[model samples]
Structure formats: C-alpha cells, structure tokens
Target: MSRTVAMVIMGAFTLYFLIPIWWLLVAGSKDTGSILTTNPLWFADFQLFQNIGDLFAYRDGVYLEWLRNSVLYAGVGGAVATLLAGMCGYALAKYRFRGREMIFNVVLGGVLVPATALALPLFLIFSEVQLTNTFWAVFLPSIVSPFGVYLTRIFAASSVSDELLEAARLDGAGEVRTFFTVSIRLMAPALITVFLFQFVTIWNNFFLPLIMLRDESLFPVTYGLYAWNTQLNQLPELRSLVLIGALVSIVPLIVAFLSLQRFWRSGLAAGAVK
Candidate 1:
C-alpha cells in the first residue's frame, strides 16, 4: 500500500480502538441521568469527582478492596510468574537435557489451550482439595502462563549468549549467581514483557475469580464491577459506581503499559534479531 493509504488505515484503526475509551471517559464524568439521556461522546453535569468519592465510599469501600486484590493478584503473581518462566526458558535454551523438545512441544500445546477451558477442571480439583472460595484458588492458577514461557525461551535463545555464561562460570560464579548477574540482566526487557503480560492477564481475569471466590471481600475489580452491573436495577446508584470504577480500574493497566513501553521496544528488537 502507498504511504498515504497506510497512514489512513492506521488512523482508522487507532480511532476505532480509542473511541470506546473516549466514550468511557466521557460517560464516567457524567451523572447517571445525563448518561442515560445525553450523547455518549458528549458530557453534561460534571459529576466525576462525586462519582469517584461515592465509588471509594460505596458498600464500606469494597471497591478499594477489590482494587487491592487485583493489584496483589496481578503485581505479585506477574513478577513470580515472569521469574519462573525466565528460569525455565533459560534452562530449556542453555541445557542439553532429556525430553527437552518434548517438554517444549507440550508447553507450546499449552499455549493453544485457552485458560477458560481449564477453569472447570481446576475448580473441580480445587473443590476436591477443599481450597475453593479462597485467595489461593485464583492466585495459584494465575501464575502459570505458557505463552510467557514460550516468549522467554525465544528471548533466552536469542539474547543470552553461551560465551557470557562461560565467562561468568570461569570467574567462579555459581549457577544461580551467574544466572542472576548475567543471564537475567540480559533478559530484563523480555522478563518485563512477560511480567506486564501476566500482570494484565491476572488483573483483567474475571471468570476464574468469579468461580473461585464466593466472598465479596475476595472479589477482584472485574468481578466486583460485574456484580454491580447485575444489580443495576435494584441498586441504580451503583451505575455511577460501576462507570467510575471501570475508569479507575483501567488506570493501572495504562500506567503500566506506558511505564514499561521502553522495555517492550528493546525486548521486541532483541526478539527480532535471531
């Protein structure tokens, strides 16, 4: 395509994606009556602050609890998942081990299997183990990301050199020390990518938490908002809470993406090299 045509196409796609966010931003700032009556793209009464205050103070500030739960699940879980994937991927890349190809193939297969497909089986097993409706039910499952492992393996193979590992070893660095100092350093960008991916996945996760957690205190933001949405008729006041809550929920994801964008660029470049 011509440059002009490509630019136009890109602009169109960008607008398509951004329009909803724009609408959400506009909608969240308006009162419930104006929201139902006004044009979605336009604003009326400025009630964003009021909505936010109400959002935070609603139902004994359960929204804040839900936010905290999401952050814990996403932030801590993502970091651990990223580290584990890095180690596993690095091992697969560097070591000549038995069943290496088979293991990798199995992991690749796992990438194809959607998480929703496994949720039922996981719930059944967790139920049998008597661990359902607890924090562990959602958190334990969120830490495993097959795609993260796949990406890390590709990054390790391309970015981390055998020469560097050998040099570290010759300098009397132990396996773990060398890995942390040399390999993980080189793999920082890729690891960040894995972390952000896992973080977003866990943050936006709904069904897993929905099925696993019966307690409102344990509900993540997504599930909590969904519950509020279901009660829109009974608790019409919750409409404002839901809208404002959604806007707030997305803030972290946006901040995270923007903050880590530089790492992503470097990581993509590294991944592209080999």
Candidate 2:
C-alpha cells in the first residue's frame, strides 16, 4: 500500500508539471480562434509548422535573433565557466594553500546569494564601464557560477587521488601539463556535469539579461519572449507567437539534457562511489 501510494504521488507530480508543457504544444498548433473556442488540452489543426513560419517572419525574424543570442551567451559562457570552475576546484582539492578553506567557504556563501539580488548592482557596475546593453553585460556575469564551483570542488576532492598527482610529478609532468592531460581527463564526468548545469542556468537566465539589455537585438530568448508577452496587450497577434516562441525556446535545453544525460548519471554515480 505504501509503495503504491508513493508511485501514485510521483505520477501525479509528473503529470502536474507536464500538463503545462502539453498545453504549450497544443496552444502553439492553434490559431487564435481555435485557442479561444476549442478545448485547451486537445490538439487544434496541425498548424505547428505554419506557426513557426509566422514566428520567424514576425518582427523581421527577431525570434531567430533571440535564439542566436541565447545560444551564444549560454554556449560560450557555460564552457568558460566550466573550465574556470574545474581549474579552481582542482587547485582547491589538490593543493594545500593558505586560506583554502576560506576560499571554499566564500564559494559556498556565494551559492546562498540570489542572482536576482545582484541584478541591479551588476547593471549599475556595467553601466559605469559602458558594458550594459552589450553582449558582455550578459555573457560576463553568466560565467561566474558559484554552484558550478561547488560541484567541481566536491567532485575533484573525491574522484582525483593524490597518488595519481605524485605519479604524474614523478614522470616529470609539469603541473599545468599534468592538469590538462591527466587530471582533466580523469575529471571528465565532473567537467561535463558543471558544463551542463551552467549551460542550463545560463540558457534559462532572464533577470540578468532583462536588467542589462535595453536593445531588442541583444535580447536572449527568455527576455525576448517576455517582451513579446508584455506587448501582447497592444498586438494581439503576439499571443500565439509568444506561445510558439516559448515552445521553441525549450528545444535546445531539452536536446542538451538528453544528449548529456548519460554523463550526468555516470558523474553522480562516480561521486557516490568516491
């Protein structure tokens, strides 16, 4: 009875979350007329392709620009963040230095600081340096992920053994060379884990972009969708476009997670064993 109840509860939660995603699909396939008249959960005519066509054509293909910007910000930012975090984490784990624990504690403290709280200050700082409304405003901040650092630290401590470092040293491998060749290869799973986490975070980021960017051309998909949503009151046509845009924005993230899912699972399993 207990197991049955637990399974049923889990299924209910899954359905609860999935229903909104299902509605986005159904809504995107619908014209405004069908959206107002037909059942919300049921499929309308298969106009998904038409909706996409209209979406790209609208506002001189602004949606595509938003998608491109998001890809740039998330992809490059995630990669850089992953590398920095991995290097810093490896250093913290492998080396005994003064203030190492303090640095670790500071990273932990950063995890507790909400990103939203920093938005206004970051904007002001960027504005002072004339970086606001530019790609750097969004991209620079996204690369600093405290949680990624935290994950890399934990993973490095357990997965990377000191004996291996000693062996590498004995073989006359310089520290930088050893880190790149041996340590990084050993830390592949952790690095992938950090990359995916930072990728998703950067991809889904809204508030930072919303604050820093004023130009429509620089908007990421999340902020772009929000702009469309706000303008829907004046431009009723944007309602359907927003729905379709929401669906479109979700695809890359889903693809990313699906492609790297095995790495995530294996990384967690490796952590558990270590």
Candidate 3:
C-alpha cells in the first residue's frame, strides 16, 4: 500500500513538471491569433515549423547568433571548468600539501555562496578592468564552479586509490603523465558530471550576461529570449517567436542529458560502491 502511494505521488509530480513543457509545445505550434484563442494545452495548427523558421530568420538570424554564443560559452566554459575542477579535486584528494584543508574549506564556502550574490561584485571587478560587455566577462566567471570542485573532490577521494598512483610513479610516470593517462580515466564519471552541471549552468545563466553584455550578438539564448519577451508590447508578433525560441533553446540541454545519462547512472553506481 505504501509503495503504491509513493508511485502515485511520483506520477503526479512527473505530470506537474511535464505539463509546462506540454503547454510550450502546444502553444509554440500555434500562430499568435490561435495561441490566444485556442486551448493552450492542445495544438490548434501545425505552425511549429513556421514559428521556428521565423524565429531563426527574425532580425537577420540574430537568434542563431545567440544560440552560437550560448554554445561557445557553455561548451568551452564547461570543459575548462571540468578540467580545472578535476585537477584541483584530484590534487586535494591524492596529494599531501600544507594548507590543503584550508583551500578545501574555502572551496566549500564558495559552494555555499549563491551565484547571484557574486554577480554584482564580479560585474564591478570586470568594470574596473574595463572588461564588461566582453565575452570574457561571462566566460571567465562561468569557468569557476565551486560545486563542481566540491563534487569532484569527494568523488576523487573515494574512487581514486593511492596505491594506483604509487604504482604509476614506480613505473617512472611523472605527475602530469600519471594524471592525464591514469587518474583521468578513473575519474571520467566525476569529470562528466562536472562538465554537464557547468554546461547546464552556463547555458541557462541569464543575470551574468544581462549585466555583462551590451552587444546583442554576445547575448545567450536565454537573454535573447528575454529581450524578445520584454518587447512584446511593441512587437506583439515576437510573442510567438519568443515561445518558439524558448522551445528550441531547451533542445540542446535535453540532448546533452540524454546522451550523458549513462555516465550519470554509472557515477551513481560507483558512488554507491565507494
């Protein structure tokens, strides 16, 4: 009876989460007129393709530019962040160095600090250096992931054995070669987790870009959609475009999660064993 109740509750939560996506699909498929007139949860016309085309073609393909910018920021930033976090975490886990606990504690503190809280300060610092409105402003900050560091540290400490490192060193492998060749393979699941988390965080980040970038070409898809959304009164036609853009924006995230789901599962199982 308890198990059945839990299943029913889980199903309810799933539907609750999926209902908005269903509405976005249905609403994005309709023209502006149909969207306001028809049922929001059901398709009125098959205008999804047309809406997508319009979204891409609008403003001389500015939406595509935004998407490209998002890809650059998220993809590169996530990869670099994962690499840096992995190295830092691995060192903290495996090496015996003075002030290691202090550094780890600081990283833990960083994990506790909210990103939004840091945004204004980061903006001020960037402005001081005259780096605001540049790609580096957003990209630099995105690459610093405290949670990623924390997670990687925990995973590395648990999964990577000290004996393995000693064996690699005994085989005449230097620290750099040992890390790249041996440790990285052992920490693949944690690294992937860090990459995905950072990727999604950078992809969906809005406030940082909102403060850092003035160039429309530099805006990520999230801010671009917001820019369109804010102009709904002036250009009511943009309403449909915003809906379609939002719908399209989430596609990459879904694809990334789907592709990397196996890694996540394996990471979980490894954690359970460790």
Candidate 4:
C-alpha cells in the first residue's frame, strides 16, 4: 500500500510538470481553425511545421534576430563570467594575499543580493555611461556573477591540490602557466558548472533587458516573447507564434544542459572517490 501510494504521488508530480509541455506540443500542431474547433489537449492537424514557418516569417523574422541576440549575450557573457570566476576562485583558493578573506566575504555578500535589487542601480550606471539601449548594457551586467565566483572558489578549494601547485612551481612553471595547465584542468567541472549557470541566467534574464533596451531588435528571446504575449490582445495570430517561439527558445538550453551534464556527473564521481 505504501509503495502504491508513493507511485501515485510520483505520477501526480510528473503530470504536474509535464502537462504544460504536453499542451504546447499539442497546441503547436494545430492550425488556427483546428485550434478553435478541437480539444486543446489533443492533437489536431499537424501544423507544427507550418507554425514554425510562420514564426520565422513573422515581422520579417524578428524572432530569429531576437534568438541570435540571446545566443550572443548568453554565450559570450557566460564564457566571460566563468573565466573571471575561475581566476578569482583560483587566486582565492591557492594564494594567501592581504584582504583575501575580505574579498571573499564581499563576493559572498554579492551572491546574497538578488539581481532584481541591483537592476535599477545598474540601469542608472549604464545610462550614465551612455550604454543604455545597447547590447553592452545587458551583457556587461550579466558577466559579473558573484554566485559563480563563490561556486568556483568552493570547487577549486576542493578539486585542486596545493602540492600540485608547489610541484609546478618547482618545475619552473610561471603563475600563469601553472594556472592554465594544472589548475584549470582540475577546475574543469567547476568552470563548466559556472558557465552553465551563467548561461541559463543570462538567457532567461528579462527584467534587465526590458529595462535597459528599448529596441525590439536588441531584445533577447525572453523580452521578445513577452512583447508578443502582450500584443496578443491586438494580434490574436501571435498566440500560436508565441507558443512556438517559447518552445523553440527552450531547445538550446536543453542542449546546453545535456552537453554539460557529463562534467557534473564526472565531478560527483571524482568527489566521491576522493
């Protein structure tokens, strides 16, 4: 009876999460006519391809431009953030410098501060620098991830060995050489984690883009989809396009996670072995 009850609960939770995705799949397959006439949860005519075609053709493929901007922002920002985090983390873990603890504490505090809380100040700062309504306005802010720094520090301390650094020093490896060759390899899993986290965060970020950018062409998919959603009142055809666009936007994220999941698993195994 207990086992049966547990299965029932698991099934219920699974359906809770999957139902919306299922609806999108079904809805994307329906044409405008079938969408009104047929059951929303069930498949109508397979217009998924047609919807995709229309999505690209909408407003001269503005959605595609939004997707490109999102990819550039997330990809570049995440990479830069991860690199900065890895360097800072390695320095904190391996070196004993003046005010090291203070710097770490500051990063910790930054991690605790919500991004939304900083949005206004960031916007003002960017505006002051004449960066508002620009890609750098959003990308610059996304790259300075305090949480990524913290995670990298923890992972570096655990994953890397001080003895290895000492040996590298004895072998005439410069600080930079030691970092790239020895420390970075050990910190791969952590770097990957930081990259994935920052990537998804930047990709999904809406409030910052919304506040910083007024140009629709510069908007990321998050804000672009939101714009479409709001226009649904005037343009009912946008409903299906928005749905398909949302579904399309999720694909790259899924691919990124799947591609990086191996590192996470390997990291876990290495930790367990240690």
Candidate 5:
C-alpha cells in the first residue's frame, strides 16, 4: 500500500510539470485563431513546422538572435562561474589560511541573501559607472553564483583528498596545474552540478536582465518572451508566437539536462555508495 501511494505521488508530481509543456507542444502546432478554441493537449492543424517558419521569419529572424544572446549569456557566463566557483571552493576546502573561515562564512551568507534584493543596488552601481544598459550589465551579474560556491566547497571537502595534493606537489605540479588536473578530475561531478545550476539560472533569469537591459538586442529569451507577452493584446497573433517561443526556449535546457543526465546519475550513485 505504501509503495503504491509513493508511486502515485511520483506520477502526480511528474504530470504536474509535464502537463504545461504538453500543452505548449499541442498549442504550438495550432494556428493563432485555433489556439484559444482548440484542445490545448491535442494537435489540431499540424502547423508546427509552419509556425516555426513564421517564428523564424518574424522581424527578420529576431528569435534566432535572442537564441544566440541567451547562449552567450548563459553558456559563457555559467562556464566562467563554474570555473571560478570550483577554484574558490577547492581553495576553501584544502587550504588553511588567515580569514578562510570568515570568507567561507561570507560566501554562505551570500547564498542566503536573495538575488532580487541586489538588483536595484547593482543597477545604481552600474549607472554610476556608466555600465548600465549594456552587455556587461547582464553578463557581469550572471556569473556570480554564491550557491555554486557553497555547494562546490562542500563537495570539494569530501570528494578531493589532501594526500593527493601533497603527492602532486612533491611531483613538481604547481598549484594551478594540480587543481586543473587532479582536483578537477575528482570534483568533476560537483563542477558539472555547479555549471548546470548556473546555466539554468542564467537561462531563466528575468528580473535582473529586465532591470539592466533597455535594448531588445541584448535581451535573453526570458525577457524577450515577456516583451512579446506584454504586447499579446495589441497583436493577438503574438499569443501563438509567444507560446511557441516558450516551448522552443525550453529545448536547450532539456538538451543540457539530457546530455548531462549520465553524469548527474553517476554523481548521485556515487554519493549513495559513499
């Protein structure tokens, strides 16, 4: 009975998340006029490819531009954030130095602080420095993931061995070399976890980018979809486009998760065995 209940609960949770995407898939395949009237979970006209073509053709292929911007912001920013977090976390885990605990505590505190609260302050600071409303405005903030640092620190503490560092040093590997080679190998799962979280966070981020960027060209998919959404009443046809864009926007995230699922599963399995 307990196992049955657990399976039911799991199925319910799965459906809860899947239902919205399912609706989008079905809706994207329908025409603008049919979207509101037709079954949201079933295809009507089978216009998915046609709709995709229109979406790409709209505004001289602006959707593709938004896609590129999103890749740049999330992909590049997440990679840099993960690298920095891994290095910082490794240092915090392996080295004993003055103010190490204090610095670690500060990073943990940063994790607890809401990112939204920093938006206004960041805006004002950027404004003062003449950096607002530019690529740096959004890209700069996307790379600071305190939670990534915290998680990486914890993982580094357990996953990496101090004896290995000593052995590497004796073998004439410098600190940077040792970290890039030995430390990163052992902490691969943790770094991948950090990159995934940071990537998704940047990809889905709305408020900070919305606050910083006044130009549509720099807007990521989240903000771009929002802009389209706001004008849906003016252009009812935009509603279908927005839904399709929303569905398409999620594809990259799905791809990333699917591509990394093996590593993620192995990480979980390793943790369980340990």
Candidate 6:
C-alpha cells in the first residue's frame, strides 16, 4: 500500500543519514592502524577510550582549547541570538508600530541571503575596524540570526494571545517585565528551536573562522580539525586525532538536542491542538 511505500522510503532515508555516523562511530573505536585495515562500518577494537585520551593529550591539550572556543561561540552566541530574536519577534507580533512591516520584510530578505555571501563584506568591515583575528570576529556575527527572528515572529503571532498581554499589563506589569515573566515562558519552545539552530550553525561554521582567525588558539573545533586535516601529509598521526576530534565535537550538539527535544514535541502538540 501507499503507507507501506512511505515507511520504506523513510527507512531508506534514515539509513542514508545514519550510515555515516555509524562509520564514524566504528572508525573512532579502532586504532589508527586498524581504521584502514578493518571494515569501516563495524568496530575493529574497543580503543575508543584510548583514542579519546590520545586526542586530548595531543599538542598539550589544544583540542580542549578548541572545544572550549566552540562552546563559548555556540553557547553564548545562540543564547544571545535567541533572546534578541524572541524580543524582536514578540514585538513584531504584538505591537502595532510604524515601519514594522518594513522591518519584518527586511528580516525576511536577510533570511533569503546566505551567510556565505556576507563573509567577504563582513571581513572587510571587521578589518577596517581592526576586529578580525579576534573571538568577536566569529562570535559577533553568530549572534545575528535573521531566520530565528522570522521563525519566532511567526510562532509568536499565533501562540501568544493578546488577551494574555492585556492581563499582564492590567496587573501593573511593565513591558519588559511582562515579556521576561510571561511571554518568554509561552515562547519557550520557539526560543529553544532558535537556540538549537543558531548553536548548530555557529558550531559548524568553518569558512568565516578560516578567513578571520590567523591564530591557532582562537580556532574553533571545526577550523582546528580542518587545520589538522590539511597537515595530514606532514603529521600522519593527526589522522586519528582529527577523526577522534570530529567524533567528539558532535557530542555537545547531540546532548543539546536530547535535552531540549521535549520542548519541541510539546510545541508541536500544542500547535496541532490549536
């Protein structure tokens, strides 16, 4: 039947996506010698802990530094981006102000423009201001998420009721007070979604850091791994380290998703009921 065909297609797509992760898991479990010699899709040995220790110990624990940078960029940037997006979206949805539609339209246009396209101009602007090669070069840009604003606006327009705002206002609550104590709770799911999206985007960002940061210590994990990848010819031992670092880098993202998925499911259910 059609339902059977749908399930088959879904299974196919699932395997297609999961096969690489499985390979990475299998490969990360093996010693460097076994990786090329053994079956890539299955475990060769239980060397996962050993590989992790080697990865952490290499270069006096520079991998840990890169991991910390990634956490700082993604965690702080995602949180700030989510807060800004929520406030902008909530204002657009609730308040009737002049130029609001124009501003929303501008944000929509920004959503259409790819981040890659802005890198060059941003580089030039940052260079002029002498901000390149610093953490701000990446972190400042990461905090501006046009898509987050657009998504939050759409969610707020429907999910947040005007009556609730009226009640809050009548209760002697100020605008900022109402938003933090009232509207923010109602929009938790959307904000979390925005945070996850921005987090992943900032975490995986490579080109901007490659272009901006000349210092190795400032490199995020993605850029640091790429730097190692490029030097594989010089330091062949880095091959195993790069693989292990990559596998380790994704752990935070997985953790974030697993922790916040409940909010997403509840949001979906609430939307369905409405």
- Compare the candidates by lDDT and give the number of the best one: 3
The reply for model 3, stretches above 4 Å from the true place, is: 268-274
Give the C-alpha miss distance for residue 108 in model 1, angstroms.
0.4
- Model 5, position 232: C-alpha lDDT score: 80
Instruction: Please give, for residues 40-121, the per-residue lDDT of candidate 3 as tens digits.
Output: 8899888999899988898899999999999999999999999999999989888899999999999999999999999999
lDDT of each: 0.91, 0.91, 0.92, 0.89, 0.90, 0.91
Indicate whether candidate 1 or candidate 4 has the larger lDDT. 1
Residue by residue across 1-274, what tens digits does model 4's lDDT show?
A: 9999999999999999889888888888777667668898999778898899999998899999999999999999999999999999889988899999999999999999999999999999998999999989999988898877787777788888889899999999999999999999988987887888899999999999989999888999999999989987898888889888988998899899899999867754553454
Error of 2 at 22 (Å): 0.7
Model 6: lDDT equals 0.91
Among residues 3 or more apart in sequence or in different chains, the pairs in candidate 6 whose N, CA or C atoms overlap within 3 Å are none
Clash counts for the predictions, in order: 0, 0, 0, 0, 0, 0
Each candidate structure's TM-score, on Cα atoms with residue i matched to residue i, is 0.97, 0.96, 0.97, 0.92, 0.96, 0.96
Candidate 6 residue lDDT tens string, 1-274? 9999999999999999889888888888888788899888888778999999999999899999999999999999999999999999999999999999999999999999998899999999999999999999999999999988887888888888999999999999999999999999888988888898899999999999989999999999999999999998998888888888899999998999899888767654554454
Model 4 weakest 10-residue run by lDDT:
265-274
TM-score of candidate 3 relative to the true fold: 0.97
lDDT of 5: 0.90
The segments of candidate 6 whose C-alpha lies over 4 angstroms from its true place after superposition are 266-274
Candidate 2, residue 187: how far the Cα is off, in Å: 1.5
Comparing 3 and 4 on TM-score, the stronger one? 3
Which residue pairs does candidate 4 place in steric collision?
none
